[model samples]
Target chain A: MFDTVNLEDARRVIAAAEKKAAAIGQPMNIAVADAGGNLVAHVRMDGAWLGSIDISIKKAYTSRAFDIATKDLATHSQSGNQFFGIHASNNGKIMIFAGGIPLKRDGRVVGAIGVSGGSGEQDHAVAEAGAAAL
Target chain B: MFDTVNLEDARRVIAAAEKKAAAIGQPMNIAVADAGGNLVAHVRMDGAWLGSIDISIKKAYTSRAFDIATKDLATHSQSGNQFFGIHASNNGKIMIFAGGIPLKRDGRVVGAIGVSGGSGEQDHAVAEAGAAAL
Candidate 1:
């Protein structure tokens, strides 16, 4: 049976990402989604815009739903056939772009983490930190 | 000088609301917005549809921005001049209906709380629990 992602693991990932962001002096919003595309945890830093929360969750949802990193989806959407429409089809819940990465354990994807509020590159960096912590 | 609402206060309100919902066995999504209409905290219970998050936040935004309970706006929009358009003008960030109430301290509005993921009456009841906790 596939077990649900542990909430403590998700919090550790977020803490690691926050530490990295703090080191860079950037505030961000982070969201974690379980393998079932259900939200596990979310945090929005004190200066981060409220919109970042939605964007971060969308990115995480896209990563978990597609079972791939959001960065790769951004590249594919630009070249694939009517791929961008997939986001609209999902009731605008999926965001195909950087800043979201699937979490893996023993080569199996368990969940996804997304970070937003900074530039794409910065957001990607923060997401990577979260993934690395896992 | 006005006192800024502390995060602990918000958490207490949310806890009370959650306890009430637990007693009723209804899952919910709740959002709290600060004096500046910015999200201070948000919680999504398991089994609550993801869409509830957006609806809750929009209700809180509408309550805070309009300086009235969201339930009142629903009634006014049906009989008043171009009132429903106000929600559209706000970039779809406001929802006019029940389930939201502004937080008051010393007779001044300090913030707002919104609840969703159940019947309108249930949502309103949960929000009232949050407000009463304050």
Candidate 2:
């Protein structure tokens, strides 16, 4: 198995996401997961929606579990797609939506970040910033 | 809803659980969930079983959702019990196993902790240490 995410990397990702969230004027719940789809770090900004906490973590979990961005999962999980109703599986942990991206190191998936408490486009932008920090 | 769990508390709980796990010579995957059954924090220690990561998080979620210990849930979900086959429901997120316990404050469930990567008794012991931190 590949090396899992460490605390430092997870913190860096969250910090980048937090900066982006602040720049975009949105409070965010950010989550990072290791290659094994286990959470490594998380941050819920004050005034962020409580409901977004789980959504963010599950999105990060989903991204790391599949080694794919959640946006890709969204297409695959759509009606008549190969992974239809995939969200209903995995105890609703599979989030087929935007705002989740995997972090790659030397062409290998090292971890992932998921952002919530903003529009999908905003969340995706912030998550991309986090991934860029990897 | 009441106030959600703070990040400091989650970290403290994990630290306590880690100490207990190390005392027993078992690396562990520890997870904490807020009262709404959402993951707040998680850690998979070095050399911990990868399969236990998701199980630990689900155990925490199940405990918070039901406001009871997973061991109690295990008993209630046994053959001829009222919650028989409960594990198959909730998209298989219900972990009717030991090592999951709620964090209660003033008799109200605030959050939960779950530990894995050892015997059920050992896991339970570690999780108890986590809950005691609350």
Each candidate's DockQ: 0.21, 0.25
**For model 2 chain B, the run of ten residues with the poorest summed lDDT:** B1-10
lDDT at position B75, candidate 2: 91
Docking quality category of candidate 1 according to DockQ thresholds: incorrect
- Pairs clashing in candidate 2? none
Q: Deviation in angstroms for B91 in model 1?
A: 4.6
The TM-scores of chain A alone, one per candidate, are 0.94, 0.96
Score each candidate by Cα lDDT: 0.81, 0.86
TM-scores of all candidate predictions against the true structure: 0.75, 0.75
Measured on C-alpha atoms, candidate 1 has an lDDT of: 0.81
A2-116 in candidate 2: lDDT tens per residue? 7667866887788888899999899888998888777776767756787888889889999988989998889899999999988998977989999899989998998899998
